[model samples]
Target: MTKDELKQRICESVDRRRSQIEGIGDQIMVNPELGFKEFETAKLVANTMEEFGFQTETGLARTGVKAVLKGKNPGPTVALIGELDSLGVADHPMVNPETGAAHACGHNAQIAGLMGAMMAIADTQAGEELAGNVVFLAVPAEEYVEVEFRRDLVKGGEITLLGGKCELIKQGHFDDIDVAMMIHTHSDSTMKKTGVSTSSNGFVSKLIRFVGRAAHSGGSPHLGINALNAAQIAINAMHAQRETFRDSDAIRVHPIITKGGDIVNVVPAEVTMETYVRGRTKEAILDANAKVDRALRAGAMAVGAKVEIETLPGYMPLANDATMVDMFEQNSEELFGEDELTKVGHRTGSTDMGDVSHLIPAIHPMMAGASGPGHSRDWHISDKEMGYLGPAKSLAMMAVDLLYGDAEGAKAVMENHDPLMSKEEYLAFQEGVFRTEVYDGETGTSEVES
Candidate 1:
């Protein structure tokens, strides 16, 4: 079959499974499991993969599911990833009854899309003609949340790392893969589209604990070393450093005081803070982290408080393979109308796919799903027709084109790839760069149970 024929076949396949896929999305949306805890969600996807004849592996990177479809002959291997986690956004009507998780991030749609694409690839005749492989990965814990909970997971060895894809990468999940492609949902009027960005921010998280002496608040306030005061001072210092960060670098530093001592009248003995430092480049993030460390230490010293810093490494900056973008753009134009492919500027978000991109050539495109702002509660997949089918079609078409289409399709994408380092070199660089300190929540400053 020609590339066009395979594309049509895949589109038809997705259409055939539209109702089934939408049902899966609805079930996940209603259940709304949070990051690293997507047990049901993972089961649903893995079961689907097994039914479709893809070789499956579970418990990889702790709740992540990996399935691979090999062609008759070996060629380039491309991976399609689906995130299986949701955000803790408040006020969602379809909230999970027990866990309070909501699929505000529209990852349910992503999984359905991946499943649809996997089905098409499994049923495609191109497998006999093309010498390549397709990988379907349903990753858990992409959304970094509840630092204390994930930190405990790291400590218990349930997972080697925090973020799902990053942990998978560290486990050499993508070592055999060559190219990776996945579509994310964005709130836009257009039914389905592609987003390309030159760069994205690298992020790091830290939990800072301040220890001070407690004393009577009203009677002997002088005897108390105020930990809250130190926290306030640190926040103020972070705000002061904001202007120094370049706009192009897109530096974001936000901190929350998780614990501010016990009683209002009693002098606070201990305080804990959770903070994030994000920047457009790794170098910028590292530099900003150093400055943040200095300011936080200064704040603690001024209040006679001893401070402890525990840092969690996050996703590296996303560098989209331009070659892959071009191939995707051409393929998208062929599948949808030429107008379906639109230019999107840089977005201020992070993903574990960034880690995969660092390992091999990768493309992460944003597909339009809703009409309002992205990641906002107002953001929703109201138009199920467009929201469900469009993402599935785009992802399926990209896979078919890359795997079955003439080498020209894959060649265009590989030509524009700006790979800074080889896969081995990149892995080495990441090993040296990314580090996270796991802390037991039971021994937390304020004693929050793990």
Candidate 2:
């Protein structure tokens, strides 16, 4: 069959399983789970893959699930990925009452689309005509929430990295795959039907604590130091550094005080804050991070308190593969017309797919089937057909285009692509970001540091 004919067959197959795909998506939306703890979602994905006659594996990078579909000939491998995690949005209508977890970012749609692609490719027997393999990945913990919990997981050697894709890379999961793609749902109405950004930001996660002497607020107040004042100073200092950031770098630093004080009657002795320093490039992110550290130290020095800062590796900056983008764009345009497609520039948000893009050819595109702001309580899948089926057809069609007839499209992508870093280099860079420092303001020196 011709490439177009194969695409038609795949789309028809996806339509045939539309109800099942939507059911899975709705189930995940209502039963949201947090990062690294998506056991229920993982089970659903595994069962679905198994039912479709694919070899499935679970417990990857904690709660990740992988399914493989072998092609007719041994060639390059392609991956269709979906994130299986939700954010802590207690106010969302579909949020879990106990855990406060909600799929406000449309991850449920990603899983649904992934399953739809799998059904289409497998049921239509499209793999029999392709020269490369296809992999369906349901990864966990893309939101980077519950920092302390994830830090403990890292300390206990349960996970090497916070992001699921990064840990999977460390575990050698993507070593076999040569190309990858994933569709994220967007809330932008101006974007029409579909969109793809050229790049996005990377970040470093930080946890800060300020320590001071506590005493009775009504008596002996002079002997006490207020850590909340130090935190306020630190936040102000961080704001002061904003003017120095280069416009092209797209630096963003937003911090929130998690713990302000213990009691109202006593002078607060402990204050904690959490934030992410995001930038367009790794160097930019590091530069902004250093400024933040200096500001934090300044606050401690001013208040005569000690400060502990812990920095963790977050997602890398995404650079979509040009060749892969071209292939996917072609499929999208064919499916939804040229006017429905839009090309986006740099986006300040980040994703774990950036880590995968650094090593292999990848594309993280957006499909508009949702309404309202992303990660907000109002966000939801507004158009079921566009939300679930659009991505399904786009991913499957791109796979056929790349893997058909001796895999010329895939080879062209590999030939033109140059990785920013090798897998070893990437791991070393991320591991190096892990650091802890305790600076004593009174002594004007580092103490009890790690």
Candidate 3:
């Protein structure tokens, strides 16, 4: 059997089960689960994988699902990933009643698309003609949940990292995989496209704490050094530095004062704040964080108070492997037609996938699934035009391309691959970045340092 024939066969097989795949998406949308807490969602996806005859592993990276399917012959191993967690978009019309979570980010669609590919390839009679191995992965916590919560999980031995796919990579879950593909569904246009980010921002998470003396507001206001006041001062300083931030690197520093103080009547003794330092490059992120730290310390000095900072390496910027992206583009056009596969436009977002991209050759593509603004309450799936099916088909076809498409595609992707930093080098950089002096929940003094 020819590669084109095999591709056609897989698409047809998945097309026949379109209804089942759509049902899976709808079910997950209705029962949305938050990042790192996708118990039911994981089970649902895992069950489907098992039905397809893939040997599965559960509880990876804390509630992740992994399945491996061996081909008729040994070749390169290609992996397809579907994120299993939803965002905390509570007001969304499709919010799950029990969990108060919603699929506003279109993760449900991603899962369904992954399922379609897994099932189709598993049932493909052309496996004898295909090359290498295929692995379908369902990852948890791609959402990058807060550091403190994730740290707790790590401390309790539930998991050792924050970002879902990063945790998996660290756990040797994908050590043998030669290629990785992630399809993120957005509620944008009708196009099915793949995007290559020349540069993506890295994130440094911090918890800021401020300490001050508390006294009755009305009776002894003069005796108190309001920690809340100090926090506001620190935030003001951060805002003022916006002008100094280099726009070329897309440096972004946003902070939220999570806890101002106790009762308003009494001068609060402590205030805690959470913040993210983002930049197009790790150096830019680190530089911006250094300025942030200086501001926090300045605030503490002005108020005659002390500040504490706790930091963690959130994620690294995503840099596409040139060869991998070129291969994806060619395969996309072949399976979906030139019209269907296009480049993304005016989009800016970050992902833990960046972490993997740093370690190995990877591709993250954007596919449309709905209309209107994405990541908002107004985000809704438009099933009329098979908006959902087109993207799902595109993703399934991408897998087919990687596993069975002309060997030239895989060869090109592999040839152009280069690691920005070695595993040891990257780990050393992260260890140096995830440093902090203080971490108090009440005082907003934690800051990501250079």
Candidate 4:
């Protein structure tokens, strides 16, 4: 069969399983679980993959599941990835009341689309006509939340990295796959039915603490040192550096104070803050991070308080593979028409997929099916056909295009691609980002190490 014929068959197959696919998506949406805690979701994916006759592996990166569908011929291995996590949007209509987990980011759609593609390809035996293997992966903790909990996990040696993909890379889960693709749901109505971005920002996570002497607020205010004041100074200093950030770098730094004080009567002894420094390139992100650190130290120095700063590795900047983008674009246009396709430029947001794109050929595109601002309580899947089936058909078609006919398409993508970093270099760089520092103003002493 020709490539188009195979794609048609796959789409027809997906259509035949429309109810099942939508059911899976709806089920996941209503039962949302937070990152690193998606046991039920992972179980669902594993069971579905097993039902479809794929070899399954579970408990990867804590809650990830992987299943492989081997082709008749030996060639490249391509992975179709779906994130298995949700955000802590307590106000969302579909949020899990107890856990405050909600599928505000539309990851449920990603899983559904992944399963839809799997059902279509397996049911039609498309692998028999292809030259490469296909892997279905449901990964965990893409949102990068619950920092304190994740840090506790690290301290206990339960995991080394906060992001799921980062941990998976450290555990060698992605080592076997040569090419990867995943579709994310977007909320922008101005965009077409489907869109592909050229690149996106990456970020480094930070946790900060300010310590000072506590005393009576009414009688002996002079005996107390205000940690909250130091935090305020630090925030102002961070704002002062905004003018120095280059527009071309697309830098973003937003910090929030998690704890301000303990009581109304006593002087606060400790204050805490969390933030991320995001930029379009590694150099830019590191430069901004240094500025932030200096500002934090300045705050401590001004108030004669001690400050401890913890830095953790976050997602890397995403650079989509040009050849993979072309194949995805073609398939998108074929399914949704050229007018319904949009080409996006650089996005300011970040994803762990960006980390994957740096080491191998990968594409992270967006499909429209939802309404309201992304990650907001109002966000939801309004168009099931476009939300669930559009990506299903697009991914299935792209799989056929890449793996069919001696795997020429996959080879071309790899040939045209040059990785930003090797696996060793990538691991070293991320590990180096893990550091902690304590600066004491009164003693004029500092402790810094990575």
Candidate 3 residue-wise lDDT at 250: 82
Q: Tens-digit lDDT track for model 2 on 157-215?
A: 99989999999999999999999999999989788788999999999999999999898
Q: On a 0 to 100 scale, what is the lDDT of residue 298 in model 2?
A: 89
Sort by lDDT, best first.
4, 2, 1, 3
Better of 1 and 2 by lDDT: 2
The C-alpha TM-scores of every prediction are: 0.91, 0.99, 0.91, 0.99
Write one digit per residue (lDDT tens) for candidate 1, span 353-376.
777777677888777665556555
TM-score of 1: 0.91
Candidate 1 lowest-lDDT run of ten: 441-450
Prediction 2 TM-score vs. true:
0.99
lDDT of 3 by residue, 301-365 (tens): 77777788777778888877667666667766765468665554322367888888888778787
Candidate 4: pairs in clash: none
For each candidate, what is the lDDT?
0.76, 0.93, 0.75, 0.93
Tens-place lDDT per residue, model 4, 1-450, is: 898899999999999999999999999999999999999999999999999888899999899999988888999999999999999998999989999999999899999999999999999999998998999999999998999999899989989889999999999999999999999998898899888889999999999999998989998878998899999999999999999999999999999999998997888889999999999999999999999999999899998999999999999999999999888888888888877778889999999999999999999999999999998999999999988998888888888888998999999999999999999999999999999999996786889988
Off by over 4 Å in 3: 97-99, 189-196, 334-348, 384-387, 439-450
**Clash counts for the predictions, in order:** 3, 0, 20, 0
